[model samples]
Target chain A: MPEDFEVNPWDVKGKVDYDKLIERFGTQRITRDLKERFESVVGELHPMLRREVFFSHRDLDLILNDYVSGKGFFLYTGRGPSKEMHIGHLIPFIFTKWLQDKFRVNLYIEVTDDEKFMQKNELDLEETRKWAYSNIQDIAAVGFDPDRTFIFTDIEYVRNMYPLAVRVAKKLTFSEVRATFGFTESTNVGMLFYPSLQIVPTMFERRRCLIPAGIDQDPYWRLQRDIAESLGFYKVAAIHSKFMPPLTGTEGKMSASQPETAIYLTDDPKTVRLKVNRYAFSGGQPTVELHRKLGGNPEIDVPFQWLYYFFEPNDQVITAIERDYRSGKLLTGELKEILIEKINEFLERHRERKEASKDMIEVYMRRGKLATVMWETVHGLSV
Target chain B: MPEDFEVNPWDVKGKVDYDKLIERFGTQRITRDLKERFESVVGELHPMLRREVFFSHRDLDLILNDYVSGKGFFLYTGRGPSKEMHIGHLIPFIFTKWLQDKFRVNLYIEVTDDEKFMQKNELDLEETRKWAYSNIQDIAAVGFDPDRTFIFTDIEYVRNMYPLAVRVAKKLTFSEVRATFGFTESTNVGMLFYPSLQIVPTMFERRRCLIPAGIDQDPYWRLQRDIAESLGFYKVAAIHSKFMPPLTGTEGKMSASQPETAIYLTDDPKTVRLKVNRYAFSGGQPTVELHRKLGGNPEIDVPFQWLYYFFEPNDQVITAIERDYRSGKLLTGELKEILIEKINEFLERHRERKEASKDMIEVYMRRGKLATVMWETVHGLSV
Candidate 1:
C-alpha cells in the first residue's frame, strides 16, 4: 500500500508525484519536441504549457498529426457541481479557452449534476441542479465562443446524451469498471454508470477530442480509449495539468468544501488578502537574520507557487521574484501581497464577465455545434 | 437450492411452483375476500384472475381501498425488447387491458430498450430500439385508450424519466441491487442502474400505482418499497401472475429465442398448428389403446394449461374438456386440436388489431399524460 498519494475521480490525498503519475497512469510526457510541434500549429504556446504545469498527455502526438494534416480536434472538459466555484476550478477552463481561440475548434463543457447528487449525501437533485446552472455562468465567464461551445448538464440534456451513454455502458462490465475505478460493493450504481456518460462527449464529434483537465480524471479516459477503438471512434486525446496547490500548502488541489483554504472566483479582495496572510504556508527561515543567511525554498511556498502557476505570465519577472525570494531579499509578506494583487485584478475582470454572462448562459447552454454533431450521428438528423 | 423451477426478469427455467414463488417472494395470495373486493370495483373478475393464474399480490388491498374511496390508481408494466413478441408475452397485456377497461385508469407501458441492450450479448442498441417500437404496436393492439395510455421506451423518454431515476438510484446501493437482482460482477453497469428507471413509472402519478406483471419481476417492486416511503411516494402495489407454460412442456415459461417452442404473435395459422401439434407437451399414455384405458393429466398438459391460463374464456367448457381428458374420453390429439383452434382464433383478432395499430403507433408513442406530468415536475414546464 503506497500511501504517499492517492488519486481517483472522487478523492485526492498526499503529495502527488507528477512524473510517477505519468508512469503509473500510462500517459506520455509532453517532451520539448512535442512543445515545439504544438508551437508550430498554434503559435507560441501558453505559459502553462511552457512551464510544464500542463505537464502530461495521452495521444497528443496523434492529435497533432491529425491537426497538421488539416484535420482539427475539439476539446472536452467538465465540472462536478457540488459547491461554489474556486480559482482552482477555473485553471483548466482558462487554458481551454486559450486553446479554443488558438485552434478555433468547438468545445463542450459537461456539468455533471447527476454525479454530484449521486456522490453527495446532503446534496439533493434540486440543489445540485441549481449549482450546475450557477457553475455554467462561471464557465461562460471564461469567454468561450457561444456559437461553437455547448454546456449541458446530464439531467437537462439526457435525451441527447443517454442514447450514446447506453451504448458505452453496454460495452462495459462490472468487473471492468470495478478494476478501473476501484469501486466496491457499496458504491452506488449511478456512479458505476457515470463514466459512460462522461465518455460520450469525447465521441461527440467525428474529429479527435483533446480533454483539458486535472490528472485525477485520467482513469475515465483510459477506459474510454480501451472501448473507443471498437466503437469506430477516435480515442480521446487529453492534456493533464498539475493541481493548483491550496492556500494552506496542502499536498493536493484546492477544494470548494473548505472555504477558508481556497480562493474562490467570487471572493472579494479583502477575503483573499486575509486568507493569504493568515493561512498561506511559507518556506522562509524563522527570523530575518536567519532568513538572509539561509535561502528559502520557493517550491513549498504557496504564494510563490500560485504566481508561478498562473498569475506571473512574464518569465523574466517570475525568475527575478523566485531568485529574490530564494535569496531572502523578498519577504513572505511581500510575496503574499504580490499574489493578492494579481488575483484580485483577475477576479475583478472575471466578476464583470460573469455578470454580463447572466443572459448569455442560455445561449451557450442550448444545443450547439457539438450537440448537433452528436444528434446527427446518433439519430441521422440533418443539421 | 430448489432446481424444480427458476424465475427472474432475465431467466426462467424448470417447473415453477406458484405457491412456492409466492412464499419465496414474500407476497400474499389473493384470497376469496380480496377477489370479492376486486369484483365490487371492476365487476365480475376476468378469467385470468378467477382462475388464480394471476394469483399473488404485494399491496393490492390498499389499491382497492384507495379505488373504493375514489382515490384511484394507475397501471404500470413493461417488456424487455430482446426479441419478437410471443403469445406468452401478451398474457399480462391482455389481462392489464381488462383492468384498464374495467377501472378506466391511465396506463403506462415501459418498453425496456435500455435493459435489453445491457443484458443481451448479441443485441445492439439499434436492434433493441427497433424491437421496442415494434412491440409498442403489439401493446397498443390490446386496445388501451390512447388518450389515457402512455407508452415509452427508456431511450425515447429518458429526458422526462432520468431526474426521478437519479433520485431512486441515489437511495439504492450496489450491494442491495446485487442481492435483489442476483447481479454478479460480470453484470454491466447499465443493468445495475435499470431498476431505478423501472421504478420511476410507479411515482409518475400522484395517486397509487398498481403494476400487473409476472412473478419474475417481483424483485424490482420489493426494492421500490424499501425506498418509496422515504421519498414521499406511495409504495407501488403489484399483481403477480404465473408464467404461461411453453409449448415444449418446459417447466418454465415460453421463450422468444426458441421459435419452435413458442408461437409468436406474428406466426401464421399453419405455424401455430405445427407448433401446438408437434411441441405441445402431452399428458396422455404413449399408446392409443393404453391412452383410451388410462386417464390423461390436464395439470401437466401444456395445451390444457394454455387454455386454462388464457385462451378459453368459458369456465364450464374448460371444466368439461378437463374432465373428458382426465376420464380418457379425450385423447392428446383432440386436446391439442382444441388449443390450436382457440389460439388461431385469438391470433386472428390480435393480428387485425396489430395491423390496425401500426398507424396509431405514432399517436400512442407521442408524449402523453404521464410524460407531461413528469416533465412538468422535473422541469417546471407549463405546456
Candidate 2:
C-alpha cells in the first residue's frame, strides 16, 4: 500500500519535508530578522527557537510587533489525551513554559479529552478522561506559573469554552472543514466540531494569541485565521515546531503507541539507559576501523539530534560533541551513554515535579483571572 | 414544478403527508390499544392522545410496560427558538405538560439555542439566546411542575450535557447523520453535532425516557435508539405529533416568518380576530344562500381543525360543529368566530401565566436537584 505522507490535525505519516511543508501550508518562514527580534524581547531564544526546531509561523510578525510596542500576547497550546505522554510530547509544553516565563504572559492549556474520545475508536470517554488527568501531571511538571496559567479539560471547562466554540462553529461549514482537514464521511461530528473548541483559546482574550504547536496542527489555525476577523477578533498567530525524531530514525516523530521507539516520562533511569543503548539509531560505520578512517555522520545520528534538539542546551558543548562524533572520537556507545545521562537527569527532576503536581493539579486547573476576563469580554457581561 | 413533501429536523417543505411519513419513518402507530393503555394510566386522556394529534410512536409499549411495573419514565421535548412562538408551536409543550402532570415524572426541556444559531444563516448567537429566553417564557406558561421539570438552553447548560453528548458523538459517524437527515456539505459542524446534545436528555435519568415531539424530529430519536442499548441504556421511546396546519391551509405549519398566517401567543385579541377573519383557510360557499344550500367541508377547515386538535375538548360540541357546518347551518365566519373566542380565552390565560412566570423563572432556571443528581451520576463526584 502506498502512503500519502500527509500531515493534518488527525494523521501524520511519511518522512515530512519541513521546507516543502512551509510552502504547502502557506506559513511564513522564521527569518533571521524575526529571530533577532524575538531574542531581543526574550533576552535569549529557547533552544527550540535557536535550533530552528520552531521553524515556521503565521502572523508571528504582527504578534511580535504588538509585543515590541508593549502590547503583550498570550500563549495557547493543547494536548489530546489519547495515551501516556512520551518524551516527544513534552516538546511544545516545555517550549511554551519558556515562552511564558520569558514573555511574562498568560498561558492557556486545553486538554482535548473530547477530541480523543471522538477520534479513537477503541477508547471510551472515561478512559480519555483518565488520561487527561494523568497528562496534566506531566504538563504541570513543566512548571507554568499558577497565577498566569490556566489548565482545563473540555468536559470540565465547557461552561467557559462552549459559548465561544459555538460562535466559531456558526461561521464554519462542512465544506470548509473538509477542504482544510480532508475530513470525509467517516469522521465523527464531534471531531468536525473539535476545531471550534481548539480555536476558542485563540479568541479567549480580545488581545492577540500566539499558539505554539507542531506543524501538524497548522491546518486548524489556517481555518481559524480565515474566520477570525469576521467574528470580531484578530487572526490567531502561531509558532510551528518540527516533530522530535523517533528513536529508530528520522522517518517520523516519536510515538506513544510504538513504546520501543520512545521514552516515557515515568520510565526508570535504568530503563531509559537500556532503551537508549539498545534502540537508538546510530550513524556510525559497521566496523570501528572504517569509522575511525572515514569518520561518522553526526547529522543523521538520533542521539546527537535529541541532544541538540533539547537535552544539551550549551552551544559550545553541542559543537564539541558534533565535531568529535564526525571525527569518530565519540563512538556510538559513548554518544548513547551521554544522551542517556542527559535524558535521565532531566527525567529525574521531571518525575519528582510530576509526582508533586498530582496533589496541586487543582490550583492550575481553576478558572482563574484570564478565564473571567475572557468570559466577560465574550458575553459582554458587566462586572 | 412538482414538489416533494420533505420533513426532517432542520427543514420542512411542501404539504407533509402524516400517514406516509409514519410509514417512511418506520415508527409504530398510536393504535386504539395504546390510547386505552395511556388513558388507563393517566385516568383521563389529554385531547392530543384522544384525537390522535400525536398520531405515531416508537417503543411506547415498553414505556407503558415500565409505567405499569412501577418503573416510571421521564418526558423530553424541546424548542428551537428561531423565532417567536406561535399558537401552533404549543402542540408538544401542552402535551408534554399533560404527560408530566399525569405520569408524575420528570420533564427535561431542551431549548436548543445553539442549534437555532447553527441552522439559521441570518441569526447570531445573541439573537438565538434572546429567543431562547423568550421561548422559555412560553414554555413556562404551559404550567409544568417547577420541582419536577427542568428547562435548559444548550449554551447555558452545556456543562451538564457535554459529557453525555461526547459519548453519543463517539458512537455516531457523519455517514449515519447524512443518511438520516440528507445533510449535504453545506451543513455546519454544529448542526451535525446537535443530535448528540439532543439525545443527552434521554440518558439524564437511568430509567426509560419518553420524548414527546413532532414527527419532524423523529430522525434524531432514530439515531439515538440505534446506539442506546450499546451505551448501556434503554432505547428512547417517542410519541410523535402531526404538524399543526398553517392558518393559510394544509400547505405547511404555522410560522413566525409569516405573521399573517400565524396567531402568535403575543398577538392581541383584535389581531388574532383580524388574522383569522382575513387569512384563515375557509371551506365555505361563495354566498350565504349557496353555502346554506350546498354546505361546507369541516374536515378541510383550518378553524375546525384547530378547535378539534386542542381548544374545544368537548366531543359532542365538535361533532355538532361538524354536523352544522356540513348541513349549511353554520358558515365559515361563524366557525372562525368560535375558534377566535376559544383561542382568545386560551391566550388570555396563557398570557397571564407567562407574565407571572417572568418573576418566577428563577425557580425553574436554577440547576436544581435533578441536574446535580445527573451530574453526580455521570462524573461520580461526591459533592
Candidate 3:
C-alpha cells in the first residue's frame, strides 16, 4: 500500500494522519494520563493540549518530573526566515510563550537566517536578514516574557555558539545527517552543518530542554537525542504540534509560495474578508435548498478547522458554531464571516502590539535578564 | 606503473618528485623569468626563492603586476593546531614573514583550532585551543610587522568569518568538497564546512590576496579560485613551497607522530644532538677506512639536505660543505655534528624570541593596527 501523506522539516504533502505520524516518528502520543498530569501541574490546560492539537512527545514525561522535583527545564524553538511569515508560523511561538509565562523558565528563539540563505539558491543573506527582522517583530508581538526570552539570529550569535556547535558537529558524520535529514550529495555544506547550530541551544542550560514545535521539526531533536547524553547533556524533550491546515483545503500545510493558500500577518481586514470569502474551503452543498436539507460537515471545513486550531479559543463558542454549522442553521457565508472577523481582530491586536513593542525587541534580544546571562556566557559541554 | 609518492593536505609519503607534482596539481613552476621579476621588484630574492625551495606558483606574475601598479596584495597562511610547533611547520611562516617584511603588506594568520579538533577523533576543542596558543606564540616569534599582522584562531574568530563562510559554503555542495578534500561519508560535518572558513580570509581584502604555503594546500585555493571572481573578488595568488624532508630520510615530510623524525621548536640542545646522531640518515660508507675512499652522496644525505633547505643560508659556506662532503673529506658524523650545532643555534634564538615576545601575541591578535580593524569588520563579499 502507498502512503498518501509525507511530512518533513522542509516539506509537507496531503492530509496527514497525526496518529500515523506519531508511530512513524517513534514518538509517544499525548494520552489522557499525560494531559491530566499537565493539567494538575499547570492548573489548566491550553486549548491546543485540550483538543489534542499538540498531540505527540519525546521525553516530555521526564521534563515534567524534573520540574516537579525542583530541577527546571528551558524552552527552545526557532524560525527559518526566508519569507514573510503566515498565520501558520505563529503556532509554535504562541505555545512557547505560554509555556514560558506559566513555568517562568528561560526561552530561546533562534532565527536561522544563515540556514535559510544557504538552503535556497536565490535567497541572499541580506534578504534573509531583512525577513529575520520582520519575522522577529511579529514573534515579539506575541508577548513572550521579555526578561525570560532571548531571541537571536544564527549569523549574529555564531561567535558564542560555535564552540558548542563544532562539538556537536564532530559527533555527527555526513552519513548520520544524510540518513536523518534526507540530505544528498547536492546538499550545500552549510545546510549539512546547520543541525549542530540548532542543537546548541538545547545544551545551553544544564537542565532539560523542552521544545514546542511542529512535528516536522522532530527529526532535529531525534539527532540531538542520539548525541546529547554522550556530550554530557540531557536529551532534549519535545512537544510536537500538528500542522495548521491551509485555506484552500485541509491537505498540506500553508506555504509562503502560494499566497492564496495562506494569509499573511500583514493582510488588512478587507483582504482577510476577501480571502476568507473567496478562498476558504467550505463543506456546504451547492445550493441553498440542498445545504438546508443536507446540512454541512464541520470535519473537513477549513474555516471551522482554523477556528478550532487557533483563531476562536473559546470552547463554548467553537462548540456552538460547530453544532449550528452541522445542523444547517449556520451557512458557509456566515461561518466565513465569523472566521474573517476573528482573524482581522487577531491581526489588529498583533499589529498594535508589534508597533508598541518596538523598544522591547532589544529587551527580548539582548537586554533582558536571560538574554544578558546568555550573552555573557559561551555555552558548551563541561569537560 | 605505481607512483612511489603521495601528497595531500593531511598526508605525504615516499619520495616526491616536485616537477611531477607541478604537472599533477596543474600549477606553474617558478621560472627564471618570474624569479628575475621578483628580484627586480623587491631589490633582492629570499634564499628559498633563489634555491627553488619555494618552487611552484599559481599567480605570482599577477601579484607582481598588482604591486607595481599600486594595486597591492596581502598575504594569508594558516596552521592547524593539533601538536607542538616543529621546524617543518615553520617553513612557510618564516618565508611569509620575509615576504611581509619586503612587501610591507598585511598578513592574516589563521590558527585552525576548529579543524584540528574536528579532524582528530581523540582531540578536543580545549586541547586544540591550548596547542593554538602555543603554536601562535611560535608564529609570533617570527616577528611579523605588529601593525600589519593579524593572527587569529578559528574557534575564537568564527563570528567575524561565519557570514562570509556561509556565503562561500552556499556555493559549494557536499559532492564538491568530497572531491576536493577526499571527504568520505564518515567525515564529520565540521570538516566538510571548514573549507569555507579557510576560504574566507582570501576574500578579506578587495585587492589581490597572495598565499605562501606548502603546495599540499593548493586544493583549497583551487576551490577558492573557482568561486572568487563570481563573488566579485580577485582570484587569489599563491607561491607554493616543497616540504622539508624528515630527519630519517629525504622521502616524506616530517611527522609529528614520530617524534624522532622531526625537530620540535622546544627540543633542547642535548635532545637535538641525540636525535640527530640516532635518527639522521647517512649517505657515507659504513667503515671510516672505506668512507675516506668512497665519497658521500650529498644529494641523498638528510643533514646536507636540511642545511641546503633551511639552516645553512650562506651560499659559499653551503657550497663548500656540499663539495667537501661529496669528495669524502667530510665524514657522516662530522656532517651530523655541523647540523646539530646549526640547529641548536637556531633553536636558542627562536626560544629567546618566543620568551621575549609574550606581550606581542596580543598585539598581533587584537591590539595591532590591522588586528583592530579586522576585529571590527565582519568579512563578506560586497552585495
For residue A192, give model 1's deviation from the true position in Å: 0.7
lDDT tens digits, residues B69-106, model 1? 99999999999988899998998998998898888888
| Model 2 per-residue lDDT tens digits across residues A294-313 | 77787788999999998999
Grade the docking of candidate 3: medium
Q: Rank the candidates by lDDT, best first.
A: 3, 1, 2
Record all residue pairs in model 2 with backbone atoms less than 3 Å apart, i.e. clashing: none
lDDT tens digits, residue span A1-383, model 1 = 75689888787788888888888899999999999999997889999999999999998888888878889888999999999899989989999999988888889899999999988989988788889988989998999987788888988777887877888888888899999989888888888898899999898877899999999999999999999978778999999999989888858778899886799988899998999999999987788887888868899999999999999999999999999999989888888899999999999999999998887777777555555554444421112
Please report, as a value between 0 and 1, the fraction of native contacts recovered by candidate 1.
0.75
Cα miss at B369, model 2 (Å)?
5.0
Give the TM-score ranking, best first.
3, 1, 2
Which portions of model 2 miss their true places by more than 4 Å? Answer: A1-4, A367-383, B1-3, B367-383
The DockQ leader among the candidates is 3
Q: Each prediction's interface RMSD?
A: 3.6, 3.0, 2.2
TM-score of chain A of 2: 0.95
The pairs that clash in candidate 1 are none
Where does the lowest 10-residue lDDT sum fall in candidate 1 chain B? B374-383
